[model samples]
Target: MMALVGPVGPVGIDQLGVYVPEYVLPLDQLAAARGVPVEKLHIGIGAQQMAVAPPWEDAVTLGANAAARAIAQGHISPDEIGLLLVATETGVDHAKPASIFLHELLGVTANCRTLELKHACYSGTAGVMIAADWIRSGAARGRKALVVATDIARYDLHSSAEFTQGAGAVAVVVSEQPRLLALDPISGVFASNVYDFWRPLDRREALVDGKFSVDCYLNALDGAVADYRNGHSTPSGALSEEFAALLYHTPFPKMAYKAHLRLIEGEWRAAGRNPADLGPAAEQSYRTLVEPTLGAARVVGNTYTASLYLCLAWLAEQQGRALEGRSLGLFSYGSGCCAEFFSGQCVAGSAKVAAGIGVADLLAARRTLTVDEYEAFGRDGAGADLPVESRANFCRFAGVREDKRLYERTGSLAQ
Candidate 1:
């Protein structure tokens, strides 16, 4: 419950960029292939489609494309970026940091600091917080920080977690007087030693206790929101009354809905009302404050580290001008497990910045893959070391040679 002490001035996300692979798998196809009811996937988990990365497209490539898109769309010069923070659960190498690869691919200057952060799905928020703090501390030296949250969520092909798998990246530029979302330096955090979800060094797919993870997520949400209410003082209203929208780290879209209900129930109890009678009320509140954030996530599945930011992007895109000047509450949860609740507000030019990133265009561009074709492609990065022709993507994972991961600039934003 310790406060994140700082100047707490106007420093936050200046621009946002996103990248999803061109390939997509509709969850109905997967449900049918698995002999499961499609409604269970569509209604139970709230997933429709998921982005599928080819073997050659790993975290490094996905992150690089996203960062490049940010630089290009935001009209930011790579030399002006002083720090590069990449957050991912899927790491390509044991020794090397993915940020270094992104630095080279995005043409960042030699003077930049590069590193990677991992804490399941929450590392992306960690990077953003660190970047904002760096700017606040004057450590950035008038240069912006680029925080890239990139991941390929993988699970056993025929397992229960399979429909939740997706791949994507979200890149944000943090700096002074940001044009997109202006972040508050204060944050509420919670952590515990729990193994609700984890992946070992030897395995490509993650292990998750579905029911336990849901419980953990709800508990962490409670802890984080309580801490947030304690430390926050500037916004002079109740949590539900102060914020225009709420976003959560979405492993799947339904998980977010559950978190909202948990928050609403807590609010109901605190107001001396019956929590059991708040179901319809909670659903209505969720529709107004949280549902807009899930459009991209419903289609993309679990983006792991990029999940929360993906929601922000979706919200900005869906609400457009309506979001300007409105404040938002965001909760980030990662299992093994840590959680944080933070605040941000949409700035004057938020709509333009969001539109420039073109989130809708990215989702509309994906090519649907057949279930058999997806299975043939596999979850492991099998043909990653082989050479292939460059496509219209901004960059690609070319091949690995002599124990080095190689990448190439295939095209530009215009293509």
Candidate 2:
């Protein structure tokens, strides 16, 4: 348990921007390609569609685009950001941090301290906490921080985890007097060395122990939630009823569903109620408090570090003004493995800021790829050599050549 020491001034997300690639793979198409029933993916796993990044998009490009959107939408001058951190598992360079490229592409001040954070998926939340603390502790001297979570979840073809692959990025601006959710200073974190999921340096895709991963995720959720309750001095009964919404990292929607069941069951058990008898009540509570948070993950699949923030973005956009002053509980988990439980209060007008990000339109405008096309794209690195028209106002991965990664900025530089 770690709590802010100084007078915690209001510091939280001031703006959020998301960039989902322009390609999508429908779960039905994937099911047919894998010779499996569509219901397995559609209902069992709860994945509807997934975003696919073209060759021109990687973690760096996605992060840069997302950060650009955040800066533009928030009307934040690049010079105002003193720290820029990127969280990712699929970084472009092994030696150079992804934030270095993003810093140049976004045109942040040269004086900014930029780095990459990695802890599987939990790195994003870690970056958020670091930024908030930096501001709260006066290290930032009123300057803001930019934290971007960007990743492309890739799995070996025909692997069990294939259907869960997706790509996207979310950029959040943190500063005092946040327009979005105001974060609490205290957070509950639990970490353990677990090998449920991982990728070695030589492997291009992840290797996962599916069953063990699920168990780890659930156990981490339970532990973090318990720590959170104990730290806040709130008993299980009150903890369950206090939150207006609960958000969690969604590798797939079904995982989140199971976690919600655990949470509801635990609460009931603590209150001396029969968990079996509260089935209908639990379902209703999940539908009301948890289901809404999965909307984006259902469509975009697992975005690694961006997973939870994407859910928060979706909630903010969908719930809009109605979420004002409501308390939101968030659980973040990363493989090999760390988990944190935290809470935030939705500020007034936060919904409008979320809605302004235009994530829905971005998803709607995507081009769907057939199974064969998708496989071919994956085979040739998504046509990395093919020439594509460059948008005038976007950041893109130009290409890699001679073992050097190149990035291009065609848009107006951040001021």
Best by TM-score: 2
Local lDDT at 75 for model 2:
89
Error of 2 at 10 (Å): 0.9
Per residue, candidate 1 scores C-alpha lDDT tens digits across 156-250 of 88999999999999999999989999998788899999999999999988999999999999999988888888887532235776789999999
What local lDDT does model 2 show for residue 350?
84
Overall local distance difference test of candidate 1: 0.88
| Model 2 poorest 10 in a row by lDDT | 382-391
Tens-digit lDDT track for model 2 on 1-415? 7544556578899999888888899989889878999999989999999888777778998888889888888888998999999999999778899999988887778999999999999999999999998998877877899999999999988988999999999999999999999998888888899999999999889899999999999889888888887888875644557888989899999988888888888888888988899868878988988999998899999999999999999889888688998999999999999999999999988877877877787788888889887787678773377345543447777776787888888786442
Q: Which lDDT value does model 2 have at 371? A: 87
